[model samples]
Target: MTITEELINKINVCTKCSLHKGRTHAVPGEGSYNAEIMFIGEGPGRDEDLQGKPFVGASGKLLTELIKSIGLSRDDVFIANVVKCRPPENRDPLPEEIAACWPYLDQQVRIIKPLLIVTLGKHSMGRFLPGLKISDVHGQPKRAKGIFNERQVYLPLYHPAVALYDPRKKDILFEDFKKIPLILKQIKKSKNDIQ
Candidate 1:
């Protein structure tokens, strides 16, 4: 089996935390194995849990549009969550839950080796950049050591769900998303220069 397939199989049967007991299915993530970009989110919500897919609800629609705006499709980038299963009543994942699922996410990053990781909420961002507010860092690219590499690049953004509550964040999300391609170009240029 492919490595991703193996990972998914493990996730499917995972009972590492309480979150699994209530989940309809484990969202192991989806998209190109060779993608340059990977999107990490907090966890699966109602729609996503039911469908066993990440970002398939209203927020997902906006995320889809944002990806399209950058001239890429769902097939072009990887999407996964910090927690593979949905928390009870869509509550925040507990610390133990995140810790239990950390190995899986770490394996994914090691496998995909994405040039950029776009964290789509505070929970996901907190894993990489602790002690920072999303408001201060959204749309900005920060380079640091990640689960897989020392030079991983990350871009923090508000969860698309935020726009559902306040429409203003939608415009900001779009603007922030616009920086992706440019940041990717710069990363590639630097890599080439190093070689």
Candidate 2:
């Protein structure tokens, strides 16, 4: 089996962290194995936990809309979470849980080698661009060295969940979504120029 498939199989039965105890299903993430873009989120929510999929709830709906705005579908990019399992009551994942699960995320990045990584929330952003305020950096592209591969481009976007709680951020999120195509083009041009 492919490394990604093996990793998912392991994750399916993972109990390294206590979060696994409460999980209905481990969302190991899904998308093209050779996608150019990847979207990473914090963790699974209610619908996601129940369905063993990422971004399958209200936030997922908004995420789909945002992806569509950029002329892409859910299948166009890889989508995963920092933590594979849902936290109790949908609370923020504890640092230990994040620590336990990050290697899997790192492996996903290594295998996919996406040209652009769109961090869908602050937690996901912290993985690549640490200590920067998401408020200041939302939609900003940062050159980040990959955990298991070479340097790559990272873009931090507000999690779609934010709009659900506070609709004011929707415009900011939409504006950020609009910037993705241009950003990908620039990355492609730079890569071709180097080659």
Candidate 2 per-residue C-alpha lDDT over 78-192 given as tens digits, one digit per residue, 9 for 90 to 100: 9999999999999999999999998899888889989889998888898788898999989888886777545678899899999888877998999988988888898988863
Give the clashing pairs for model 2: none
Question: What shift in Å separates residue 108 of candidate 1 from its native position after superposition?
Answer: 0.5
Question: For residues 52-162, could you state the per-residue lDDT of candidate 1 as single tens digits?
Answer: 999999999999999999999999999999999999888888999999999999999999999999999999999998888999989989887777777788999999999
Backbone Cα, N, C clashes tallied per candidate: 0, 0
In model 2, which regions exceed 4 Å deviation?
Answer: 191-195
Q: List the candidates' TM-scores in order.
A: 0.96, 0.95
- After superposition, which runs of candidate 1 have C-alpha atoms over 4 Å from their true positions? 191-195
